[model samples]
Target chain A: GQQVMQIPQYQHVQEGEDFTTYCNSSTTLSNIQWYKQRPGGHPVFLIQLVKSGEVKKQKRLTFQFGEAKKNSSLHITATQTTDVGTYFCAGYTGKLIFGQGTTLQVKP
Target chain B: EAGVTQSPTHLIKTRGQQVTLRCSPISGHTSVYWYQQALGLGLQFLLWYDEGEERNRGNFPPRFSGRQFPNYSSELNVNALELEDSALYLCASSDGTSDVKNIQYFGAGTRLSVL
Candidate 1:
């Protein structure tokens, strides 16, 4: 059974601060996907990483996949109130094994 | 290109009652996945349906069951619901055309409140 473990269950950051969340999987993964769920909203796909050591950036957000494909990280720069949400890392095999997620609270 | 769609934005049920949730995948998508997100908890995998077949399920009890339709839609049935069943049930879909990587597109989940 594959499981994804996320670090820092909750985080409160001041505006303009940086935030980072890490995810580690119990088994090797074929790909890793990141999602964000805003309050009262569904989980929205952010990005997907398939190659080992792959790095992708979206504006102030950066995503990285471990060389082993068993870990991933999401980093947000210059946090804003609009960035408030729970970030999830899902490992994809035939199905998805989602991490517990890291809830980010940005303080204005 | 429509995203995944789920029915009944919210639902209310009582103990010993039964509930059904419906989900329609995006056009051309053939895989549907159901997940339960309890308050302050993570998304717990409920079931996976591909090509109108029950492909896999999670650690949930037998009371939690579902089936896929011929058109790639899905219905999740929960029998003898308990108070702990109160959670947000999310339905996601992916293109099952030998892509190998499952990049899921989620729908606005149905919030089920079991009393």
Candidate 2:
């Protein structure tokens, strides 16, 4: 069985602070995807990284995939009140396996 | 184009009962996936259906089963449900093509409560 673990299950940061969540997989992944879910909402696809040691950015959010393809991280710069949500990293081997997710709370 | 659509936005059942949740993927999407999300928890993979066939399943009991229709729509059935079965059931769909990267689009999900 393959497993994906995420760190800092819960994070609370001030409005102007930066936040980062790490994800590690028990086995190498074919690809990794990031998602965000608002309170009482379903998960929404964000981005996918297929190349090793790849980094992608969307506005103030940065996503990086490890060179070994077993780890990934998502960093949000200068968090805003609208950024409050649960961030999840999913790894794909034969099928998709989701991490427990990191809930981010941005204080205004 | 519409996103994935799930039925009966909410359901309430008691222990030992059976429940069925339905999902219609976005047109032209051939893969449907089921996941369970408990209160304050992450998404747990349940089942995957493609081309009206059972493709892959998670570590769930036989009590959890499902099927895909010719239209690529799917139904998830849970029999002999227990209190622990209460959770939000999310249905997602992806284009099962070689060129596509298998990015899943999710439905609003069906909230199930078993007493």
Candidate 3:
């Protein structure tokens, strides 16, 4: 059985600060996906990292996959109040296994 | 383009009752997956249906079962529900195969409350 763990179960940051959440998997992942869930909304796909040691960016959000493909990280620069939500990393096997999300709260 | 859609946004049932949750995948998508998310917990894989066949399932009891329809729509049925079954059920779909990487589009979950 594979297990994915996320760090910083919760985070409170002032607006304009940077935030990073890490995810580690007990087994090697074929690929990894990142999702964002706003309060009261369903999970939304943010990005997918396939190649090992891959790095992708979406405006202010950056996603990276470890060289071993056993971990991933999502970094948000200059966090905004609108960025308040939970970030989840899902590792792919025959199916996707989601990590316990990191809840981020940005203060104005 | 239509995203994943689920029926009965919220449902309430009692222990030992049966509940059915429905999900419609995105157009032309062949892979559908079901997951359960208890409050404050991560998403747990429930079942994977592709091409109208049960491809994979997680470590859940057989009480949790589902089917894929001809149109690629799916239904999750929880029999003899328990208070522990109270959680949100989510459905997702992708155009790729079950293994490896594929972008999954999710549906707004069905909140199941068992008393």
Candidate 4:
């Protein structure tokens, strides 16, 4: 059985500050997927990292996969109030195993 | 294209009762997955259906079961429910043909309340 663990279960940051969440897997992952879930909304796919030491960016958000492929991270720069949500990292092997998720709250 | 769709946005049932949740995958998707999200808990894998066959399941009781339709749609059935079964059930679909690299799209999910 594989387990994905996320750090900083909850975070409250002032707007314009940077926020980062880390995810680690107990087993080697074939790929890692990131998702965002707004309050009371379903999870939405954000990005997928497959190659080791891969780094991808979307707007102000940056995602990175560790060289071991067992860890991943999502960083948000200059967070806004609209950036409030829970970020989840899921490791994929035979199936997807989601982490506990990190809840981010940005203050105005 | 339309995303995954689920039915009965919310459901209320009692312990010892049975409940069924439905999901319609995006057009052309061939794999469906079910997950349970309890309050303050991570998503727990429930079942995975591909090509109308049960491909994988998590460490849940037999009371939690489901089936996949030929049309690629899926239904989750929970029997002999308990108060702990109160949680949100989410359904996701992906292109099964890809095998290793499937990015799942999820539905809004069905909130189940068991009293």
Candidate 5:
């Protein structure tokens, strides 16, 4: 069975501070996807990584995939109150396996 | 294009009762996945359906079952519900093609409360 583990189940940061969440998988993954869920809202797709040691940036957010394809990380620069939500990392083996998720709380 | 849609935004049931949750995937998508999210918890995989066939399922009992229609709509049925069954059931759909890396789009989800 494949499993994805996420660290820092909860995080609270002041505005303008940086935040990062790490994800690791029990088995090598073909691809990894990141999603964000706002309070009382559904999970929304953010980005995906396929190649090993790949790094992609979306505005102030940066995503990185490990060289082994078994780990990933999401970093937010200059946090804002609008950044408060739960972030999830899902790995694709034969099927998609979701990490426990890291909930972020940004203080104004 | 429309995103995944789920029916019965909220449902209330008692223990031992059976409940059915419905989902309609985005047009042209062939895969649908179901997950349970408890309060302040992560998404727990339940079932996956593609091309009107059962593709995969998570570590859940037989009481959790579902089917996909020819049109790609899906239904998840939970029988003999327990208090722990109270959670938000989310429905997500993917293109079911390898090229897209199976990127999924999720619906708002149906909240079920078991008494």
Candidate 6:
């Protein structure tokens, strides 16, 4: 069985602070995906990484996949109120095992 | 194009009762997935249906079951519901292909409250 774990179950940051969440797996993953869910909203797809040591960026957010493919990370820069949500990392088999999610609260 | 759509949006039921949640996938999608998110918890995989067949399921009890329609739509049935069954159940759809890297588009989710 594959399981994904994430750190910093909860975080609060100033408007301009940087935030990062890490995802680790009990077994190697073929790929890893990230998602965000606002309070009272459904989870939405973010970005994904498949290749070892792969890195991708979306404006202020950066995502990376570990060389071993057993870990990943999501980084946000200059956080804003809109960034207030729970960030989840899902490790997949034929199906995905979602992390417990990291709740981010931003203070302006 | 429409995203995944789920019915009722909210459901309220009492213990020992039964409830069914519906999900309609985006057009042309062939795979449907069900997940339950307890308050302040992660999305726990419930089941995965593709091409009108049950391909896989999570570590849930037999009381939780579902089926996929010929059109790839799905219905999740929960029997003998208990207070612990209270959670936001989300439905997602994907092409079930590697091209999308198994990316899943989720619906607004049906918030189920078991009294």
lDDT of 1 by residue, B1-115 (tens): 8889999999999999999999999998999999999987889999999998888999999999999999999999999999999999999998873425478899999999988
Candidate 4 chain B worst ten-residue window by lDDT: B95-104
lDDT of 4 by residue, A1-108 (tens): 688999989999999999999999999888999999998888999999999999999999999999999999999999999889999999898778889999999999
Q: In order, what are the TM-scores of chain A for the candidates?
A: 0.98, 0.99, 0.99, 0.99, 0.99, 0.97
DockQ of the two-chain complex in candidate 5: 0.72
lDDT per residue (tens digit) for residues B8-97 in model 5: 999999999999999999999999999999999999999999999998888899999999999999999999999999999999999975
How much DockQ does model 6 earn? 0.65
TM for every model, in the order presented, reads 0.97, 0.96, 0.94, 0.96, 0.98, 0.96
- Candidate 5 wrong stretches, greater than 4 Å: B97-99
Task: Please give the lDDT score for candidate 2.
Answer: 0.94
Candidate 4 lDDT over residue span B1-105, tens digit each: 999999889999999999999999999999999999997677888999999999999889999999999999999999999999999999999986352658999
Query: For residues A22-85, what per-residue lDDT tens digits would candidate 1 score against the true structure?
Result: 9999988888999999988889999999999999999999999999999999999999999999
Model 6 CAPRI quality: medium
Residue-level lDDT of model 6, residues A27-53, one tens digit each, is 888789999999989999998788889
Per-residue lDDT for A53 in model 2? 100
**Over 4 Å off in model 6, which ranges?**
none
Candidate 1: regions farther than 4 A off: B97-101
Model 1 RMSD vs true structure: 1.2
The stretch of ten residues in a row with the least summed lDDT in candidate 1 chain A is A90-99
Tell me, by TM-score, which candidate is best. Answer: 5
Kindly list the per-residue Cα lDDT of model 2 for residues B4-61, writing each as its tens digit.
Answer: 9999899999999999999999999999999999999989999999898888888899
* TM-score: model 6, chain A: 0.97
Model 1 residue B22 CA deviation in Å: 0.4
Error of 1 at A32 (Å): 0.7
lDDT of the structure predicted as candidate 4:
0.93
Each model's lDDT: 0.93, 0.94, 0.93, 0.93, 0.95, 0.92
